[model samples]
Target: MSVSEIEKYGKINNMYKVFLDIDESSESNVKPMLTNIASKWLELPNGFLASNTMDGDEIYIPNLHMINLVIGN
Candidate 1:
C-alpha cells in the first residue's frame, strides 16, 4: 500500500485504510464496483465506522445497494 499525505479537505479527510481482496476472477472488477458505490447514495444507519465488516475481503457497506453490488446480488 502506498502512503498518502492527508489532505485538509473533502469527505474522506480522516483516512481509513480498506483492503479489498475479492476473488482473483473478480479482482479487476472490484474497482469499478467501488466507483459505482461511491457515486450512489449510501446509507449509514449504523454510522460510518460501524458500517463495514472490518476484517473480510468483502467490503462492509451500510447501503444495501453497495452490499448487493459487492456480493454479486
Candidate 2:
C-alpha cells in the first residue's frame, strides 16, 4: 500500500510520526500491518503504540528518539 493511502486518513506530525485511527474494514485488524506500512513510509523503525478508545482504535508512531536528538531534548 502506498503512503498516500495511509495518509489519507492519518495525521502526520511535524516530527514525521503518524497517528491513525483503526479501520478494520478498510485495513487489517492486526496492528502490525499498519505499523509496518507507516514505518516504511515514514522511514522509522517498525513499531506502534496502540490504544482502544471510545471513539475507536488509535495507532501512534513515536519516532521520539530522533525528534529528541534533533530538538536537543
TM-scores for the candidates: 0.26, 0.20
Query: Which candidate gets the maximum TM-score versus the true structure?
Result: 1
Give model 2's TM-score versus the native structure.
0.20
| Best by the lDDT measure | 1
Per-residue CA lDDT of candidate 2, range 1-73, in tens? Answer: 2232223324545434434444446454444454532332222244333333313433344433321101111
Which lDDT values do the candidates have, in the order given? 0.38, 0.34
Alpha-carbon error at 36 in model 1, in Å?
1.3
